[model samples]
Target: MILDLNQFVSKERPYWDELTAVLKKQEEQPDWKMSLPEARRFHYLYQRASSDLVKLKTFAGEVEVAQFLENLVARSYSRLHEKRGSTIPFRPVHWFLRVFPSTFRRHWIAFMISLFSFLIGGLFGAGVMKFAPQHKTSFIGSFSHLSGKPSDRVAKEEKKQFDGFERRNTFSAQLMANNIRVTILAMVVGVFFGIFTVFLLFYNGIILGVVVFDYIADGQGVFLTGWLLPHGSVEIPAIILGGQAGLIIAHAMFGWGTNLRLAQRFRRIRSDLLTIVGGAALMLVWAGLVESFLSQYHGPTVYPIKIAFGVLQLIALICFLLFAGRTRQPDSIHAG
Candidate 1:
């Protein structure tokens, strides 16, 4: 029911003022704790203010009263319900499942550029090693000696990585450290206007290609597939994402579309980079574990298992990036 604007204000203003004072006290004195009776009174006042707001809207030309009620009710609701600062719960699982994938989807173009650069570079390198074997040393120096030799060198190098430590644990840790180092390097070099990031992607791709060709030349294709794909599937994508993060920063600084102020753009870019880089690091840790423990074990018995595992992992990763955090688009129908 409608009342005179003056009468409505006269009746409701006291409750509004009381609720406002209670909320304000909490704001002003951090150490001031509300007593149980006071909290119950505050909640009752909040309910009264909400009901008053609905009534005030019924009075035509009571704009000022409605606005005051709106503010009072909001502050009271916040005081009673919202958690602030350190009170908020931290859930890593929620962040990974929801926040990370959404961030990945937002900056997917950078990932594509990184992925294509590495893949094309690798394919080109492989073609060169196959057709122009004479120049294999020019591209891949250390691996050059392995060409046409037995696969013993590859096995020996694996052994060397785990020489001084327990096989699974320390080797996994070392592998993680090394992979993280490379990913960080890729990210750091993106500051060179992304020129260095591009170089890194191509370099990594080329090395992979050369190594694969070398293994093939020695008639160890299956062995290389089991060892490489298991970890490479995850590790390579993570490294590319790190590069993607850096390139995003480079783009914010120098590339096209400077509609935002420089500081504002950089702030937005920084937030996106944090999520991308963090997710990439997590992937690298998984890759390192697989590389050290699973990929290195390449006998006939475990060969098919490793290859299948790699395929499944790669598929799951792709699906996660593509579909996770995606909401169905609303229908475009509109009422006439």
Candidate 2:
């Protein structure tokens, strides 16, 4: 049956106002969770209100129409209402541009702000490198030496990350899946794990910082760059971006409200979060290709190795500019 508007509007105005506020929030900004009852409530409320507003506009006294419109508008905002659905039928260009400045801004901005943590993570990673191996060595000495040795047959079979080969030595599927896995880890862990993402990033940074120190200390810093830069340039940044997304959810939790309403807020943020997560996935794809092909090709030298790294990194950068930059060619844009 068609729902009766009078049954809805005849209710006391103040109570309606409160419910309206919650509903508006759902419309404006959905929550970031699996469930979104608050948003659903707003959807139903707005649909009803829109109907009532039209009815009052048509037949009700002028005073009543104004009141009805006022109530409809009020419900939209009291819950921090934002646009949940497309106002018009379609806005492809608008959506394409949407994730750039709005939803994903926090990912980049958070990184800039968290630069201090990066330095700290590096320091700790270095510390772990210096201290942890020493403690484990006595018991692990034989295994450690064995551990360092490449089990070529097993290594190739598993594409064990420890064998220190990337794309050049490994197969494409291994490269792609592993690279994507790390990128996905960054986003998924952050979203599900919340502030724990800080630890994840920090831990990785620390491990990396220490590794760099070890390589430079051994006068193999150049070699290290050759090994890492090709895939890592893409992989590391993607992971950090994922962590930033997690932070957004954590921040949302800081606000006060009912569980239903919070779910609504998350629902609103999902589209934007996907942009960051998707970017992470893309980076992983690039990393896999670089690791599987170039990284496996040359061993330990800048010319054959690092040279390849520099060239590929540059190509990736150029690709990014052409695709995302304003001056991209029409044909390329279409191709992209």
Candidate 3:
């Protein structure tokens, strides 16, 4: 086949130069990490340059260009296959503050799907409660305590006080254990193509919707908000994050866009799953502490404070997820 060597060299030189610039930058900052898009582009450039070198070798005249392309491909290959180790030590604070949030943003679509499933369940539960009150018991399930009137329950809780710090601590431990178990289950069930994970999320949302609607319908909206928001603000999101991890796992199982093997797909997403679940666990721990220490408290005097705290916490979390880990400077390259 006749080859337009001059046209090809002209067209490919820009890509080769771009690869050179990226390589130079990496050499200057050995700890720098490429974002996903940058990594993909770099890979494409490597492959293209390698192809160009092969084509050039077929012709005997372009020796200098061929050598340059060979070196470019070699450097890119080395960088791509380098040992998966970081020169910088792992820092827990950095991981939580930056890595966790960044990971969450990376899979925001899955998170939205998780949230949507929960909302659908909530709507269903609320509809049942509003239209058919007798079946409340069926929907309430384990939360039989809420079967009674919201006002009566609120009154009882308002007058109730903890007997001692020991009781509070015990309650907190129980809450933590229960919530963490639920969150873990939500993530682990992703192995089943996320069907169970979606159901779990939806079921939890049904309980929430039923409880919230019942309280509001009975004129206990303020009480309900104060009781739930303090801990639910973080606890709810944590559970949703667990759902997100599950869906991510499910996507890997399906392997919709890639031809990678099942093992390879799982390997690619394993770190992301762990990162999301770990973040959720941490959030649940905080939620448990808040629920036991603050959320369980009742009365008009403290309700506003608890509500405010919860709102602020939720806002801070939103900001962290949206903006954390974003910087002009490069980060350390780490596996997903």
- What's the lDDT for all of these models? 0.81, 0.57, 0.90
lDDT for model 3 comes to 0.90
Error of 3 at 57 (Å): 39
lDDT of 1 at 244: 87
Model 2 RMSD, rounded to 1 decimal: 12.6
Q: Per-candidate RMSD vs. true structure?
A: 10.3, 12.6, 13.3
Best by TM-score: 3
- TM-score pick, better of 1 and 2: 1
Q: How many backbone clashes does candidate 3 have?
A: 0
- The model with the greatest lDDT is 3
Clashes (backbone N, CA, C under 3 Å), per candidate, total 0, 33, 0
The better candidate by lDDT, 1 or 2, is 1
The parts of candidate 3 lying over 4 Å away from their true place are: 1-88, 162-166, 329-336
lDDT by residue (1-336, candidate 3, tens digit) is 645777987898899999999999999999898999998999998888888888788854576777888899999999988776545776889999889999999999999999999999999889988998788888786876788999999999889766455588888989999999999999999889999999999999988988999999999989999999999999999999999999999898888999999999998998888899999999999999999989888999999999999899999989989999876778879999
Deviation of model 2 at 20, angstroms = 31
Query: Order the candidates by lDDT, highest first — what do you get?
Result: 3, 1, 2
